[model samples]
Target: MVQYTPRWVGKQEESIHIAHIASVKIDTNLLLSNVLIETTGGANPIRCHGHHKADAVRMKALIERYQNDYYRGGGAPVGSAESTPAGR
Candidate 1:
């Protein structure tokens, strides 16, 4: 989740599961960056603003890696598979 404290009334937070994420976009200036994370549920996109360019790039990379792993592994639990179908 990305959180921002706005004037102390309450904090605002945004989160999306890797499988629910529709897209991740990044916009960069000379030094700063912004990220937009869109979800398949059609809710408000998560807006991440004013980060370093390198950090934004890293965030995008991590998200992509997670998404890839989730899809490639069929959302399996960590180390749950053991016996082969033909054997068991």
Candidate 2:
């Protein structure tokens, strides 16, 4: 899960699993970037801001890589909750 937790209380944390992520949009200025991650469901998108350009690019790349690896059944380690066993 990609979690974004706030420092202050009374605000709920945002978490979007790799499988649930539908799309990733990035807006960049000269110094900072904003990454908006929308989910497959109708839930609100995860909007993260104020990141370096390289960091923003790298974040998108990593998410896509993980998504591909997950679907290929090689990303999740064996005997972990994220990975299901064979034969139900």
Candidate 3:
């Protein structure tokens, strides 16, 4: 599971389990790099910014690895496809 604390005023932290995460997207530009974590729990993806591009990439990889491990361990919902991709 990944625990993320959003940089928002008066906002509480949130926890995202590996089995529930749908995707991890990394967006980078000349100035900043951000990671968007999409989950099956909601419509809004978790946005994490202010990290180096390499760090964001590493985070994405780690999340995908956990997700893959979850599915391989038979944690995916019944009747769902077993060979689903790690990220969308």
Candidate 4:
């Protein structure tokens, strides 16, 4: 899970599950780095900022790994063949 706290008032905190994430993008300027997380639900993408460029890169890599694993069935699904009594 990823939790984001807004930089200003009147904005509620947001939490996103890795499984629900569709993509991770990074944008960097001279002083700040932003990580944009797009979700399958089509809501506003979660924007995480104030990170270093290297940190943003790492975050993108991690999210991509999770997304890849999620799509490729790297983790066993509930009642999947790997979880069946005979297949176990």
lDDT scores in order: 0.75, 0.79, 0.75, 0.77
| Tens digits of per-residue lDDT for model 2, 1-88 | 5565566765566666788889888999888999988899968878889999889899999888778878787667334466765523
Candidate 3 at 86: error in angstroms? 28
Which candidate number maximizes lDDT? 2
Residue 24's lDDT within candidate 4 is 83
lDDT of 4 by residue, 1-88 (tens): 5574656665566777768888888899998899888999999988887899999999888777666665677664444577467777
TM-score of structure candidate 3: 0.69
Which parts of model 2 have CA positions greater than 4 angstroms off?
Answer: 74-88
Report residue 83 deviation for candidate 3 (angstroms): 21
TM-score for all models, in order of appearance: 0.73, 0.74, 0.69, 0.67
- Candidate 4 regions off by >4 Å? 6-13, 74-88
The best candidate by TM-score is 2
Rank candidates, TM-score, best first: 2, 1, 3, 4
Of 3 and 4, the candidate ranking higher by TM-score: 3
Clashes of 4: 0
Residue 43 lDDT (model 1): 88
Which pairs in model 1 have colliding backbones? none
Ten residues in sequence with the least summed lDDT for candidate 2: 79-88
Off by over 4 Å in 1: 1-7, 76-88
